[model samples]
Target: MSNDDELKQLRERVQYLEDRAAILDCVMNQARGHDRHDADLMGSVYFEDGVDEHGPVIKTGPEYGDWANAAHESVFEDHLHNITTHTCEINGDEAHAESYVMGAMRIKGGKIVSLMGGRYLDRLERRDGVWKIALRRCTVEWMMSGDSSVLASGAVKGFIKGKWDRTDPSYTRPLLLDGEPVSRW
Candidate 1:
């Protein structure tokens, strides 16, 4: 109808898209934090008083951050988390979401690898124009084991090595590279 009305509608739509993108980023950032053992970055995804029910353990957001980072460092030699899918429902400043997560890990000083499947049910809220999880309920589906000896011999060339910190190639990799690469970790 009116130009102003159309402009307002467009603005609202943009805001919604922006909110969704930010929320997705927040979710992905959690995995990256875990993979990198970055406790502070992981903690930023949740509210200060947020709750996390991780099946056997229930703790506050801060507590979860500490526990998770510690466990990964002590128990897992290497781990990677993948977010497969998620459904989000936005209601103004409040939102509800359920995201599927898969984790693969190699235990410390061992050749056995494990796979874990789960979902993260989150209650999010926007405060001070920033959206963060207020509560997260984790549901574990299954866990299976595998042998890592097949690939443990040596990593093939042209594959980027993963690190457990900001030093990871994903963080500092350049957009363009010419000639043969020369690096490994």
Candidate 2:
């Protein structure tokens, strides 16, 4: 290719990457707000068919919504989700993103509940000129004791730390269920 053509191609490639990164950031922010029990924020991020694989259960759009709302009502008076170390790749109209998420929930008793930390693997699609999550899988890395009662009562807690890159070794951990390692990734 000529020099000018090569430069144009490189610029286009950079622009594509930027667009994908922006979309991923939006998705992450939405998820963070949702984790903090903001249904309105979560609703903005998900498409009609969005699927959430949380822990050992698979939740469809409505199911996920119910779960989120219920959890917010029962455990938290307020919540905040922190997302970091995001890595994303775009392939035409489809893309995949992985991000580290940490969340803290303020419980009714004035105690904080935190889910250790985890990575979110997401499948995104460009639909009607907007990027939205089609599928998402959450992989918990570890948990810390924010509150014994909350932990005993099945509340999750924690904040994300470490690097955010798809090729980072941190994202390679296997999932677990009921103290047993899960086979599906």
Candidate 3:
């Protein structure tokens, strides 16, 4: 191929990689925030009307946000979410992304602990020139015993110990219940 043609191809390849990386970053940030009990951060990654299915029932945007915040608060004292093996497909303004995630949590009591390994399947859309998640479904591929004390301690450590600062726009608000803010600590 001609030098100009090769350069053009290289540019296109670079653009594609950049786009993929951006989307991956968004998904990773959202997952990390959720694991770390950062509700606002998790909400920021989704569209206003996004759908989330973390449990048996699917939840709407507002419901998901509420549940996420509350659930994270009640869970562990600290958490670390590691994502890997991401596979993404882009078509026009829509895309699908999937990744494997392994998470560890430290509970409030030193004796209790919890861990979950899962796969996330996400649907994304380009909204107003930016890519945002429209739907996210988490499949818990595996989970360890849920120890209350260990979970609480881990959550406290995860949120209060500044682990949530690794990402921009952290979700630092208190968890809510029944539309009202509730204390999880």
Candidate 4:
């Protein structure tokens, strides 16, 4: 191949990688937003007209955050959305992605924890130099429950608890340890 053609191919390869990375970031950020109950962060991953369908529940992207936070708070004291086994197919400015999700949630009474596995099927588009989900469909693959009574034990109490807000340690910047660590839920 000519030098110019080789350079063009290299640039195209780099752009493809960048696009994939951005799409993965968008997918992961959605899970983080849900875990933290951050409405703005969750909504920012979608386009203005994006839509989300989670089983029988369907809502616009911008409004889904509040609904999701409320639903989660009602049943679980804490929860996490873990993403795994993600695959994406890109074509021009549009892409389709499927991400496996494992949701671990602590029941309100701390007596039991639920483990649910699912997949997020997304149709994403690149607009104005930004990648965002235009449509998302969620599927629940399987679920199970486990005892979480140990959470009330003294050993668990000593650990720094997580918060469903921006105050969570994950959001801490510079991450310097102060005089003492306080467990704030």
Q: Estimate each model's TM-score.
A: 0.89, 0.67, 0.72, 0.96
Candidate 4 Cα errors over 4 Å, as ranges = 179-185
Q: Candidate 1, which segments miss by more than 4 Å at Cα?
A: 155-158, 173-185
Candidate 3 local lDDT, 41-98, one digit each (tens): 6777888899888879788654675686566567655677889889999887899999
Clash totals, every prediction = 0, 7, 23, 0
Query: What TM value does model 4 have?
Result: 0.96
> lDDT winner among the candidates?
4
lDDT of each: 0.85, 0.68, 0.73, 0.93
lDDT of 1 by residue, 10-120 (tens): 999999999999888888888888898887888889998988888888888766777998877888888999999988999999999899999999987758889999999
Model 2 scores a C-alpha lDDT of: 0.68
In model 3, the worst 10-residue window by lDDT is 164-173
Clashing pairs in 1: none
Range of the 10 consecutive residues with the lowest summed lDDT in candidate 2: 161-170
Better of 1 and 3 by lDDT: 1
**Candidate 3 global TM-score:** 0.72
CA RMSD of each candidate after superposition: 2.7, 13.7, 7.7, 1.5
lDDT (10s digit) by residue, model 2, range 1-185:
89999999999999797768767766775665465444555666667888888888787754575677786668655565678788888887888989888866657675566555888898888888778788889998987646536443434444332222232233355632343322221
